[model samples]
Target: MGIQINGKGLLIVLSGPSGAGKGTVCSALRQQAPELVYSVSATTRPPREGEVEGISYFFKTRKEFRRMIDQGELLEWARYVDNYYGTPRRFVEERLNEGKDVLLEIEVQGAKQVKECFPEAVFIFLLPPSMDELHARIKGRGTESEQVMTDRMQAAREELNQIHSYDYVVVNDEVARACHHIRSILVAEHHRRDRIFKEQPDWLEGI
Candidate 1:
């Protein structure tokens, strides 16, 4: 009989440039893998139209954000354009303790912090098929002004430069293919030799 395995949960970070379809890919991944838990970030920005308060993000006031930071309740916090964003440490830690695989869709900076804190966490960077395609995708959104788009494009370039730091880089040419690749990676990670060995110590008896 095959030996039963006890697998520990992993912290999976998905980061990519704007217009790379990171959100679409992540959504597909969640649908394909029910066990993967998506992290909800806390932000000081006013909730956008139809954005749920706690689902899409944990909308908070500037004062509340500062209070959370002061209490050391967040894993990583950053301020951008007069707004604050942070990952809630307690929520993630609690889920991890329950043996749930957590997925964090964040920026490269936040991904770097997660890697520093959890060296074993898996890092995946998504990329666009081409710069032209990236621009087209962003424009298709029809939500940003020229200046905001320019800023996003610039940020995307900077984020691309840090691709070497990630464990896996997937070019999201097609949503289905990209999601399949991500699922395969997670499945393969679960069957890693080190993890398998730890889970089935008796398998080493013949060695």
Candidate 2:
């Protein structure tokens, strides 16, 4: 029998602009690959309608979030919309150690923080087909006011400019297709030379 290469789980950071359908793609990925754990961020923003405290996010007071920062518990953090949001270090570390791939769905700024802390992470930048389509999608969602929609579009443009920074760029024209592409990227990463060697040390030595 051939030597087995133990697979080390991947740390994947998925980021995109507001109207890029990143959340939709991520949801599809989770459904297809039930093993992927979505890292629920801790946020100071009040829970939205139908958002459970711990499930959607670990809702924390600004003071409590600051305490976590002081205790060095957060892996990466950023302030947005007058609130703080951060990924807890302990939670991600524990999952990685247990060999479960962890997915972080966050913004461009937050993804930068993750890159700094976890350089091994594979970053995927989700993009819309075009700016006009992005605007149409954002407006169609009907969840935000005109002013908020404008602001989101502006932010999306800024985020789009940084697409070259990422390891992989997936233009999310079709939800299912985009999800399939992302899943392929993740699966391919696990079979990389370094990962394969690390997971099966004896395989390299015997050859």
Candidate 3:
């Protein structure tokens, strides 16, 4: 049987620049730590190829998304290119209440907003080896127009300055190595004196 923890789950927020391999690193971390819950965001944009409705994102119409915002149902939200993207508050809260660590892979703007609401969350920033490599990776996607690519590069430069706000930084030079660092962070966080004591059994008291 697996060990049962009595404490509330951790809220882990990950953010990075456009070509920082945040998705790739999150995928590897999920495979390694299957017990961790991946937070599914809600978006007004239509699903792309192979994207599932609730699994990838809860597809909401613009009106519905705005309603959710008005009702305070989202943890954090942002608009990009006339599309809305936001983290739903209920699902993440339910999972955390059940003692399942929840991970949110979001953009830097949304991550900053989440920090205001959830100051206890583990904030991690993903980074590329270098700016040149980041540019190369963005161009390698081959789907964006020249203007779009230039805009993304400029955004990346600005996002890099936000690294100081995060609690940890993981460089995605190698997928396995990056995942290992993240796992270490999780383990260390769990072993924190407060978290450990919060989960300690009543029977161990006065021992």
Candidate 4:
């Protein structure tokens, strides 16, 4: 009789500078690969129009979020503009243990913390074709003031310094091409000899 090969899961973390089209690429990746689980983060920020609980965010009060931090219930967390946002440990672990790959799209601060907590996780950094392009993308939004845009451009430069921490980098010159690169990375990762052996130790048992 053949032994059953255990199929484990992966935690795929995607991050980039603010104007690097992280959301665009992630949304496309999800549409192409619906089987991947999208990780929902816990945040103290209130829901906006049409945002749903457990979908947009796991909305929590400041007290609740503080308790989670104190109890080590969060895998990673950060305070942004005076609001708490974090990845809950239990939520991610439960899905991972069930052989479902979880896709987490996070900011630089939160992504840095997650790298420390889960070294085995796949970390992908998305980048614009050039700094000028990134600045243009931010300016194109027109929702922010010139000063705000300048600040974001500066921050993006700082965040780019952390690209060395990621396993792969995809330049977002085109959304389709970027998505293809990311998808290829995910597929190739599953075929790595070490990963194959680790996730399915008994694949050849009794053969």
Best by lDDT: 3
- Cα-based TM-score, every candidate: 0.83, 0.87, 0.87, 0.91
Give the lDDT of residue 183 in candidate 3.
84
- The residue-by-residue lDDT of candidate 2 on 56-131, one tens digit each, is 9999999999999999888789987899989998889888888889999988888887888888999999989989
lDDT of 3 by residue, 1-207 (tens): 333444788999999999999989988888999999999999999999999998989999999999999998999999989999999999999999898899999988898889888888999999999989998998899898999999999999898889899999999999999999988998888777767666654535555
Backbone collision count in every prediction? Answer: 0, 0, 0, 0
lDDT of each candidate versus the true structure: 0.86, 0.88, 0.90, 0.89
lDDT tens readout by residue for model 1, 37-88: 8988999999999999768899998889999989988877788898999998
Specify the highest-TM-score model's number: 4
lDDT for model 4, on a 0 to 1 scale?
0.89
Give stretches of model 2 more than 4 Å off. 1-3, 45-53, 143-147, 199-202
Residue-level error in angstroms, candidate 4, position 34? 0.8
RMSD of each: 3.0, 2.4, 2.9, 2.1
What is the alpha-carbon lDDT for the whole of candidate 2? 0.88
- Considering TM-score, which of the candidate structures 1 and 4 is the better prediction for this target? 4
Which candidate do you rate higher for TM-score, 2 or 4? 4
RMSD of 2: 2.4
- Answer with 1 or 4, whichever has the higher lDDT: 4
